[model samples]
Target: MSVTGLPSASGLPDLRQVTPVDEVGVNERVARFQTRSIKKESKIEALKMILSMIDLTTLEGQDTPGKVRQLCQKAIHLHDSMPGLPHVAAVCVYPTMVGVARKALGDCDINVASVATAFPSGMSSRKIKLEETRTAVAEGADEIDMVISRGAFLQGDYGFVFDEIAAVKEACGDAHLKVILETGELGTLDLVRRASVLAMHAGADFIKTSTGKIQPAATMPVTFVMLKAIKSFYFETGRMIGMKPAGGISGAKLAVHYLVMLRETLGNAWMTPEWFRFGASSLANDVLMQLQKQATGVYQSADYFSKD
Candidate 1:
């Protein structure tokens, strides 16, 4: 069933043979996900689950050791006022801050994820990308979130993109590799689908939506297309890959809708943080507010939460 130009052996399916996305169908499907209703108790559980699936990220030019430590503390002690709260899945920071975050998290269950391979832009040489990945892993980063070269993929150099991801995966050693497609720059849903397939075939543990620096980051239609690609790839090759929709998702209801989409598309198997994640730092406060409102039947001020 491999498409002629897809080059599955080389870890890339021919783009011409890749299925063309039906934008209308995808949009219609995503619209339906927003309409599904969750019971009160179920919504409470969903909020907690969302909290645990967050990759609390701080990827900015002004990031410092102190800020990274504060972010780690927030991750470790999320709303200490609450009786019980699940720590986030990971703390995402730049490669230089990987050591800071790793030391700050100590032995907590939360993973330390570093964005390597010229993150956000993916404009550097492959050698530097691989070296950055290795350095992060050596610094105790449990996961590596590498951005794919959108320029290469956009120019139809699928092989280059595939090889780059494979190289990064190899450089990751034992650390999991999450490949960011930066769907915002991908331009079309069809291209997004192609990139998703290309990434998974190249040994990506997870296929991410964006780098959170793009305007149209992590839209439902884009995430939906990526999820479907993951499901299709899993059926083709018995391997389960994870999904992350970073940026632009900051509300509890919308986040819950994403969970609904994930459940319905990939089923309950991909429900955990290992298989899915939200790459938003501000999302945590919104979810916390929602949880408090649900518990006490009233919402709290956003000022109550720390904004690190």
Candidate 2:
């Protein structure tokens, strides 16, 4: 079967042999945290703290080639327009658009990210997935955002999911790989945690939530669970993986909350774009709005900030 197409179980090796971590240990710990106490005030405080740390800017899914080119121009303009303007961590786009972003961003230090491996639905064969990742990297994508095999993962086929991620990582070469858990479909917090651990063990450099294709994406509870997983994984492996909570993460307050969780859970190490990012298109406007509020002490209308 082609890597881009789905593989039947009979045609592939059992993934259990390649997995590195103890599944049971991960599952148990994740379950235990489900009932743990989380103070409302503490949560709010965490959000506020992280918001302060954020570059508070992002650009996603520019769509057309011309539009992406324009977005890149805007980024350059923003770099010069705003005083103390912190550069966005990366510009995210569809895999096919990687080249456009690369050219648009030029020699700028900002990263160009692409979603690959049958993103939004990881039902394709491993061969196609690997090629997609390789192709994206070859096209100058500094980072790859690939989705996990949610169907197999939900069915408890942990080994299949594990192997897929490992193969994709191998294909990524030097580019950073961000594995999207699609946490919205993972159902329970325990499952989200397990998926996070599984991705990390499979050599994921970052674990992300959602493709923005499903509902209830990137919620506080879901992000909290993933962050805890990151902390635990660090304890076990001594490697600090990145975290990205995407999908419907619009508005400054909500974005700040995500940052809050990252800071409180992972500390200062994760505040940078290297360790954290917001995968959003509309979020930039919200962040700008909030910044305006901070600067002028007044809320601004969306119309004031251009959506392009």
Candidate 3:
């Protein structure tokens, strides 16, 4: 399919090949070594560390205006009320609701993220996709989460995928573009790696996995492949791209495992919110409970966790 009204074959790059990684040998070694000690942290300390990297974006389909506003308020409250209040990196919502989050967040320094480009499916016309991205950015979305056309990518139409991302990047202007590969549907480690490189070359600030709409989203094995791809891309272009594994990640322990993987695969530079993020809604409570457990030496019931 043609992306952004441009012919699929024109202004696109070949996607069958992989980038070389000979120069990153040293960085990879250092990352692997640093991550080796991930198992040493106590459960509570580990949870706190990972919770600090969360984005806490909400994207439920049943979200109403009232609920969206409530989520925004809760996010703001968390930013203020929580002790030592490590604010979530962003508050993600639908494109139409960007204004709600923007109005509620108001100079809070938290990014307002929106999912566009036929999100969750990516099966729309390129014109609509571009307009969607442009509209989201115009609506004050600081970060744009877009899904790749799996049909086109799997059909050997890598060029189509690449141009789509590039066109969306152009629409984003100053907004950060996060390209979601929908790794569950991509179905192979090699495709994940190729898609990662394609997104980076097309100007993606981050390469994400899943729309949180698919089953088996964000597995560690797939994440491992994508992290390696990020490492390889950095070696080639010297541009550090972010990684986000969304969907079904609901507990502090799982988040820490992802953090450990990131620390091991990309080193300390990748540990911060700029380089890594977990897209989750229920994860915060689990992390909080773990934190409470650490403080009191007893596990807290689910009731003790905040429902916001």
Tens digit of lDDT per residue, candidate 2, span 165-233?
888988999999999999889887767877887788888999998888899888777777788888987
After superposing candidate 2 on the true structure, give the runs of residues whose Cα lies further than 4 Å from its correct spot: 1-62, 79-81
Off by over 4 Å in 3: 1-14, 19-45, 79-82
Scored by CA lDDT, what does every candidate get? Answer: 0.93, 0.73, 0.79
Using TM-score, rank the candidates from best to worst. Answer: 1, 3, 2
TM-score of 1: 0.97
Reference-based TM-score of each model = 0.97, 0.80, 0.87
lDDT by residue for model 1 (191-228), tens: 99999998998999999999999989999999999999
Better of 1 and 2 by lDDT: 1
Best by the lDDT measure? 1
**Candidate 3 per-residue C-alpha lDDT over 1-308 given as tens digits, one digit per residue, 9 for 90 to 100:** 44432333444444555753333553455345445444334655566566666766778788877877777766666524347646678888999999888888889877889999989899999999999999999999999999999998888777778878999999999999999999999876777877887888889999899998898798777777788988987897798999999888897766877777777678999988888888888887787777666667788887755566
Candidate 2's error at 53, in angstroms? 8.7
**Location of the lowest summed lDDT over 10 successive residues in candidate 1:** 1-10
Error of 3 at 79 (Å): 8.6
